[model samples]
Target: MKKIIFVDSTQIGLFTFQAYILELCNLNVGFGIYIETFDIPLVLFEKDASDVVRLSIDESLVQFIANKSISSRIERQQYFNQLLEFVKSSEELAAKIVFKEKEMEYLADSKYLVQMRNIYINSGNQA
Candidate 1:
């Protein structure tokens, strides 16, 4: 069966908290993360077997779901719909970092965020 791990990005000690999501996300699974009202889909590996992503993250109200297998397109859409409500009521700080809807302008379109994920994972693993 697939697993679901929700990350709490709003908590203190980023590197420490990241370890959970990082470890699970590296297992070639369907890892996903959602913070506050911010919703961004994170995939550990893009493959046909992506399902039940064993996520390592903090627990929060706006829960991010990761499937273990390739879910139907329709099902995925429904999942998104359900998430909207939970995300809408989430905290603002985490929402800014998770969603691409922010108007920060500075790091808005920057690809470094993806890079930062890698860096965070790499560094956390070493510590």
Candidate 2:
């Protein structure tokens, strides 16, 4: 298990013990949940390490999260504002080029049924 940190424009989401890079790829590939290497002063994951995958979130996902987040108007605005600042401060794009290329190569091979299966299995989960 690899410890990894994922920082976006506003907040940082930490994923502990990343087992496989392919699983991260599959996560984005299947769910459009973009997770990639961070371009920052302190490198979160080693360049050659495959256990940890960086998280790269974008604008569309922002809108999606905003809608999904059960926050008040002020809170949402604060979150969105922070995202804007991050976008302005950072110039490097999220680490998605490789996965994006592979997705293009195997466009039709998406396992949509697999996503449904995971969803069904987790739907009954109660916390």
Error of 1 at 67 (Å): 7.5
Model 2: which ten-residue window has the lowest total lDDT? Answer: 14-23
What are the clashing pairs of model 2? 35-55, 36-54, 36-55, 36-56
Candidate 1 achieves a global lDDT of 0.31
Stretches of candidate 1 exceeding 4 Å from the true structure: 1-69, 92-127
Shift in Å, residue 24, candidate 2: 18
lDDT of 1 by residue, 1-69 (tens): 133445444332211111012223445423233333334333221223333212222322212222221
Model 2 has an lDDT value of 0.30
Best by TM-score: 2
User: After best superposition, candidate 1 residue 57: deviation in angstroms?
Assistant: 14
Report how far residue 63 has shifted in candidate 1, in Å.
16
TM-score (C-alpha) between model 1 and the true structure: 0.23
- For candidate 2, write residues 1-127 as lDDT tens digits: 1323333423522211111222233243211222234222211211223533333333333333433455554554454444334433331222352233221211112343233223322332122
